[model samples]
Target chain A: MTRKAFITESDVRALAADLIAAGTRVVAPGRVGTPLGERIEYRVANKVDEILLGQDEPARSLKDFFLPPTDVILAWQEKKDQVELTPVSSTFAPQVIIGAKPCDAAALEIVDKVMDWDYHDELWFGRRAATTIITLACEGGDRSCFCTAVGLEPSGTRGSDVLLTPAAGGYSAEILTDKGEKLVAAHAVRFGADKGADEARAFAEKGRKRVDANLGLKPAEVRKWLAGHFDDAFWKSIALACHGCGACASVCPTCHCFDIVDECEGLGCGVRRRNWDTCQTAKFTMHGSGHNPRADQSSRMRQRVMHKFCIYPERFGEILCTGCGRCARVCPGGMDILEVVSKVNEMACGGAK
Target chain B: MAETKILAFVCNWCSYGGADNAGGMRLKYPADVRLVRVMCSGRIDPVFIIKAFERGADGVIVSGCHPGDCHYTAGNYHARRRFAVFRELMIFMGIDPRRVTFSWVSASEGGKWRDVVSETVERVRALGPFEGYRGLTGRQHG
Candidate 1:
């Protein structure tokens, strides 16, 4: 069993302050100013007070920390006769993330399966090893939140080193890994007896009940229906409103496609970078010979769903989605992924709709 | 410093013939421009232009027959409509749309081809090399 202890709100702040004072980078959820309005986002925290741990969902997830929007993988310099290649460093400095959402934290582990599948990504695993994730038990965002439906709970501890549950007086922190134990052991004075154990259980129970009402489906059954319905007309109708903007993939934690480009800095000197790419774009599937396998938005949209609910699970033994529902929440076309998933569940249970 | 590099995609029926006519007339233009002959302007996809920039072309030009003079009847018309949307997408992707130029050139317009090459080379030379795209490589992470 994992070790449990209580950390008062003030002690948590002191611990963060200590980390910052020691020159360690700390990232947490905080308000960010955008052109539209203020939204909560995970940003580098300069002070302890900037840390916001609550039920509010950040506009973005934690994937960017590990897999950046763009990064240089290598650089090339052409000589008179030969070319020299310089590989980018894969090592990263140690850091800590506080108050991460359970859905966002679990996403890293889910994506880890592929990063280590055929070719192990040194950069991704380098950052993963250099950082310790402290996840805050969620209240599960609005009805769009469906972690429970995807075999995760509001207080799930899949990818977290330490799981913190909100309770009366303070938070009950469960040390699940050696990293978490090291953190608590160094700041032993900041931890105490687990006084909020009962209240933490109640808080988790209430959160589960609230999220359970969002969507109910069997993952295996949904995958079966999706695998069999590759050419169904339902895909065409479901994608009628979609414009293939790819905003869903931008916000989705598990959509990990990337495009590599070699851009020249000057004559004969250039860098090869891998930038974030999505399957929703026409160019993503466009062949050099002017042939496009996915010629329409319908096929593209179906590919997104199929990859998440069917293909990944069939290969990885788990679903690709944490059911964060950011895809449904940010879609400009008003397309709902969960609604499509619920339809799949219905068809798998009874008959095709 | 090296001279600016500009890539031009020209139609086999019109713009390519215009370039050949310029060569036959012995007209002097900037040697920085490189020509790529295509069956029609409509055959050029936006990805080709993007790929050109990725491969170190500082600027790009697409020249074909006038709208009504297309050999396939509507190849230039399709190219016009596609480029209108593609320019906007380039802007959204943080690329300066000014780096791309679209023009009409008839097979007999050799003087016009020389003027187009001169102007495009001058404009792109002022804009300098596309260092903005190169800078994007290591920008997103710490």
Candidate 2:
């Protein structure tokens, strides 16, 4: 357990139960019944039977738990002569996430740059410090996922504490961090001796090849192209079909724009909250005079791409996306990110217009 | 002092002067319109209008010089084109078109400014308070 080891499929399940029984939150990708069919989503799993071993990517990333869609930031009360306000605290309980996709895991680390840029986001890092991530090698991404292109492989352990690859009995577990080593040590009975040094190499190789076929682009080249094309006609044509819905932001792991609102509940008291918002809408940049910088869908679309590729990279020295492909999958309009990136890369390389 | 808070952005050369003329002539209009004067209507960014609405505006107005009479030559024309696109986006986002009003006023048109403010107040009163962006003021959930 101190080094590389082998965990049987049933042993992994037992490990999940052990974590839950010890009052630690155990989260994993599980099947939820939707109108169409079963959708895999990361949910709190209590028992071994609840965890979905290897399935499709979750409908959303782990960002939902860390950042949350909406949360209260502060509460206030007004008196005759004075106003009182109280701020929210950033503290979380220890938890374990099993079966996380590598792209999703890497997203956490990529976003960590922005969350800690100027203001150290207390809530974001609070959850990060308290949770241990165990990523499952991905093999299910279609043509939309591009984790490898953004310096992450399907089996990459960029943000994971432990990396689990499917092997003969269950998973070939590679202990990644101190937390991962501790996790294996705590459940040493579940993980057996390693079969070999490269026990899980074959499994990771196949998974990597599967996602590699999706799409690839040079992140630096795309950033360079975006830097020069702020007013390009391509932005207009590329987003022509977009209905300006912010669904892409809702699914994006790295798209972390939020609106802070103060809500008066009733009778001299209120709460200030932050909710997820996106630049895809005109309201995002609207001024008090009814003037909008990103006044049209075209400009808003360009902002989204520029933030992910150029602006974020130039400012934070890192691209703001993990290439999880959820945005393309959930787009109601035919707005495909792969097409957008490919076009930018093509333009950079002096290829097709 | 009015219960209905209306955010009005006025161009310094035209709409602002028109509003000043109305005040000088003692022309009565709804006091609900809180005015913020910009050197030119073209200086207005749609985000300012959005921030006004989000910050608890019942209604908003963007008044500037008439099409050809902009003191900045063609500043109002640029604003006109910008609003044309911004209005379409607002409608697509499910915001009521009536909640936001746009008009062109000249420096000599004090009577017109009075009428526009009164009519806009009435129209917005009929529509009632806009709580779509209530989260901004700590009033209610959006």
Candidate 3:
């Protein structure tokens, strides 16, 4: 059975302070001053006061912590006629991520399927093994959030070691893993006896109801339509507004394609790095002979939706997206992924079909 | 000052010939530019420009035939439309669009090619190397 505890607001703060004092890396959602304005962002907490839990959504997801936007895979140097290679280490320092959104947390687990599928991604799995995630049951996210529609609840605990739900004067912490149990045991003084289960349940239900009103779609039906409709007219006109800027992929927690490039600093020595890449661009499918398979923005846009809903599910047994809606919110051309997927669902499962 | 590297994508029948003429005339132009000949300006995708930046080019130049003088009819016209949109994307991604120069140079205009080269090299030198894109490569975080 999962252990339950009532962690008061003061205790939460104290725990963060203790973790920081002990030289542990603690990440939390905090107010970040950006050129755009003060936005919530996940960052390594320097002070306990900087840790903000359960309010506005962070501008970016927790995926960046595990799988960074850019990483050096290896470095090569010229030695006479033969080239020498130096491989980067995959081991990482232990860290704890607090206040992860359920959708963002679940995305890691869903992507875990592919990361370990064909070849074991040592870099990806290295960070995963070293970190623990504590998810805050979401109470805020605008109309863009639709976690419930994608089989994830606002208080879902899929990839989280501990799930904290808001309650009266505290949070109801459900310790779901050995990591979570050990954390609570180490800080036993900071927790009280379980007393807010009812309040947490009520809070979770309210969050679910609010998110459900934003959008709804049958994912399986949408996947079926995407699998069969390779030449659907809906795709040809779907991305007229898309600039193929790939801003959506930058923000998407699950869009994990990367481009490997060798950057030579001098004549014979350089680093081979992998930077975040997206399919929305023409070059993603371009051949060396200059033939592009997905020549236009519309076809590229189709690939994004099809891969998320159909290809990933057929291969991994679960949908790639967690309905985080960052793709919709970040798209410069106002391309709403939820709306596009809903249209597919309507075409496949609505009364017309 | 460190020498800036400028990658130029030139059309085979027009800008390539123009570059050859400039070399033949010994017109004084910056040696910063490394010319890559393509079949047509239309063949240059924005990804090529992006990849150029990723590969350590301080700046890039795309020189094709004069609007109506493309060896393949309407090649430069297609290139023009693509560059216009690509410029906006470059700006959005925090890259200065000025780092990329788009110009027309027919085979007959050897002096014009020299001028384009000198002007682009001077402009890119002022902006300096693209460290912002370089920062995106290599290990950023753990």
Colliding residue pairs in candidate 1: none
TM-score of each: 0.75, 0.70, 0.74
lDDT of 2 at A136: 85
User: What is the lDDT for B9 in model 1?
Assistant: 96
User: B1-142, model 3: which lDDT tens digit per residue?
Assistant: 5689999999999999999999899898889999999999999998999888877788999999988888889988999999999998879877798899999988888999999988888989999888778556435447
Q: Alpha-carbon error at A178 in model 2, in Å?
A: 1.7
Best by lDDT: 1
What DockQ does predicted model 2 obtain?
0.03
Model 3 ranges off by over 4 Å: B1-141
* Number of the predicted model whose DockQ against the real structure is largest: 3
In TM-score terms, candidate 2 sits at 0.70
Preferred candidate (lDDT higher): 1 or 2: 1
Model 1 chain A weakest 10-residue run by lDDT: A262-271
Q: Model 3: per-residue lDDT, tens digit, A262-324?
A: 877646888888889999999998999999999998899989998899999999988888888
Rank candidates, TM-score, best first. 1, 3, 2
DockQ of 3: 0.19
DockQ score of each predicted structure, in the order shown: 0.16, 0.03, 0.19
Q: Number of clashing residue pairs in every model?
A: 0, 26, 0
| Interface Cα RMSD, each model | 3.8, 8.0, 3.3
